[model samples]
Target: MRRVSAISWSLSVFLLSFFFHLLPLSIWSEPAEPTPAEWPPKFNALLFENSSGKLHVIDFWYDWSRGGSLRITQNQLAKLTYERSWDNGTSYLYPSEIHSPCWLMHIPPGILRPNWMEGAIYHGQQYVDGFLCNVWEKVGVVWYYEDAVTKTPVHWSWIPFPGEQSVHVITFNVGAVLEDVDKWEVPDYCFNNNNKLENDEEMKASAF
Candidate 1:
């Protein structure tokens, strides 16, 4: 009887070990990082998220910004930075944590424009060879991102364009992503045709 009991106990232990190994790996570990295909939408990631040149860290644009201009020649732009008020988080208007690595413009009285309203997001970067992984002289150098449109305006005066004065822009945390300004129905973010943004630390970044 004793011998029979011992054999049964050993068998049970082996069965348990086999079942444990058969269980899904996730049962004992955290999930894997998502691929690019699974990155956006799930992480609530933004499509075509870019800082206006050579920032070492990743950032997001959450609001609209106005004033000042940036010079983007070829793929190169001015270096950029900002004050971090809201990190990654949840919201309705701003659905996820916003990474605004530039100005956190407070309600100042004088310089506020239509596009430069309160809670509007903005960013800038001065790239030497553009902000993509491709090498220089790469054909189709600018790869576009996927953006979901909300009620954004079709033409905002504050965005960076192929002109003498390019205003820097970035977006984050908003529930809907936007295409070019002409594709939506919102306000125009006016810009100063004369005073373009300087490619310096003071002009590119801010603290909240």
Candidate 2:
């Protein structure tokens, strides 16, 4: 009887283990994986406000190309000064006729944000225009951006200046206009800016 009972217990245990092995492996506990390519591509255009009172539009990830060449139009050609090339070698900042509101200053290799465009504008120390019309372009696309910032007279420490020692630093001193951005016209089909790029983005740059 003892032998029989022991044999029965062993067989029961073995059968239980076999049944569990036949069960779907997922019955154990790992997290479900996320679907592939589920996230939609996105872009951003933000006008930031500082402690003082200025406004700034911070843009990230936009495509501006339309054709083999940049799809810039004749109407917008007047806005751009012209395109010129440098030696493409290591160089310094403050190059002549660069004609950009922000530029990458000469920076040594291996530095963070070295020799890259900044999110900045040359504002003012006077009680006047803080934003100025500079230039406009988005990445990965060929089109003209409108440099609509009005110039200001007072200078803020947070504001960016080309060839300044800082990198990617910018300013939006004491003339921030939230109402203006709300009305800016953006292209209706812009994947990033679902609204039209408002001309008013630069309207309040000079207004207090």
Candidate 3:
């Protein structure tokens, strides 16, 4: 029942103790604070729909686009691109007039729940993609599964209330090296003004 910077930190901290058995925990009072966890530098995966049973390949990277994160999904229809920025707003690209769903890209939990600590609860450990994970639930609604080895979220799901189709993700190649230039490309046919997004802040609020 202790606070850790991330799931990976928890595993490393405890494992390191076994090596330094003589070191007192008190001696680490001045240890540097750990950096907050972030999405992997690169990722590629296929998301399979449980309802329609369709599948699509999705790719992601941080700062891979114009000073923002990029998420590209490709299916038989066409490729859908979504880009969001912390400082600016969000934008999207698709062949038709379809608006991008926020779940297409990963968003940091810290941003969604600023006061997460007040009601955050650790739900012990779980396994995702064969990686040990730290399970966390915030305000009893949103759940996060972070890889203990990478300190990055491997899965996240949110159920609005009592019953609904829980939005979830299944990650593959958890942290594989990827080329940003190749994964972030938006097709030329997707630049119609009709597909542009609204204010990111407002859109995120509604999407979540």
Candidate 4:
């Protein structure tokens, strides 16, 4: 009877060890590092932004190959504004109501490439904007979040030298291009001012 009891206990221990070894590696390993999905070459998105306590709703159009990005925004006061940035380091800001003169500036490229977040430091995962996201920080200037399951961007915050701005992506339409070619053309009024922003100054400005 004693020998039988000892054999039973040894068998139980061996069975437990075997079961544990059979478990998936993912169960025991650390969570994998997060990789941000590349932005499509041409896409459109609606963005909600909070910039230094000011709120804005923006209709954003991006065309990487053309090296142009257009942002049409309605501010909290319901005033409409348009901003256009190009790869040649030119940007135009105009108001729809013509209350203010259009402003043009020469600066670095205001748009980033698809692999902008490549090699960014992954800060692990968290719940942001009600979605489970894999977070990453790029060059200590931007915090980017992408949904873990869908791999779509959920939120991103820019911490520049002067202030911080957070942008929430309301909607993203991949492969969607703006059909209106005329929208990419800068208004003639913008060339009137011909202002230029230094590289350092560009850092203080928003880049999307």
Clashes of each: 31, 36, 0, 0
Q: What are the per-residue Cα lDDT tens digits for candidate 3 across 47-157? A: 432213334454544432234445455544544435433324434433223443332223333122222333457777788667788777776666767676677566665
Local accuracy by lDDT, each model: 0.29, 0.27, 0.49, 0.84
Q: List residue ranges in candidate 3 displaced over 4 A.
A: 1-36, 40-55, 64-66, 75-87, 96-120, 150-152, 160-192, 195-208
Q: Write the per-residue lDDT of candidate 1 for residues 24-118, one digit (tens) a residue.
A: 99989965422111112211122222334322222333332322111112222433322222122211111112432222223224322322322
Ordered by TM-score, highest first, the candidates read 4, 3, 1, 2
- Give the per-residue lDDT digits (tens) of candidate 4, residues 63-119: 899888999998887668888988787788777754356666766656777888998
lDDT of 4 at 132: 98
* Worst ten in a row by lDDT for model 1: 86-95
Residue 135, candidate 3: C-alpha displacement in angstroms: 0.5
User: Pick by lDDT: which candidate is best?
Assistant: 4
In model 3, the worst 10-residue window by lDDT is 108-117
TM-score, every prediction: 0.24, 0.23, 0.46, 0.77
- 151, model 2: CA deviation in Å? 40
The stretch of ten residues in a row with the least summed lDDT in candidate 2 is 66-75
Itemize residue pairs with steric clashes in candidate 3: none
Stronger candidate by lDDT (1 vs 4): 4
Candidate 2 structure quality by residue, lDDT tens digits, 1-208? 9999999999999999999999988888674432111111222222222323322223222111210001111111123211111223221111112222212222234221211223333232222133333332223221111223342111212323321111121332332333333222222222232222123333223121
Better of 3 and 4 by TM-score: 4
- The whole-model C-alpha lDDT of candidate 4 against the native structure comes to 0.84
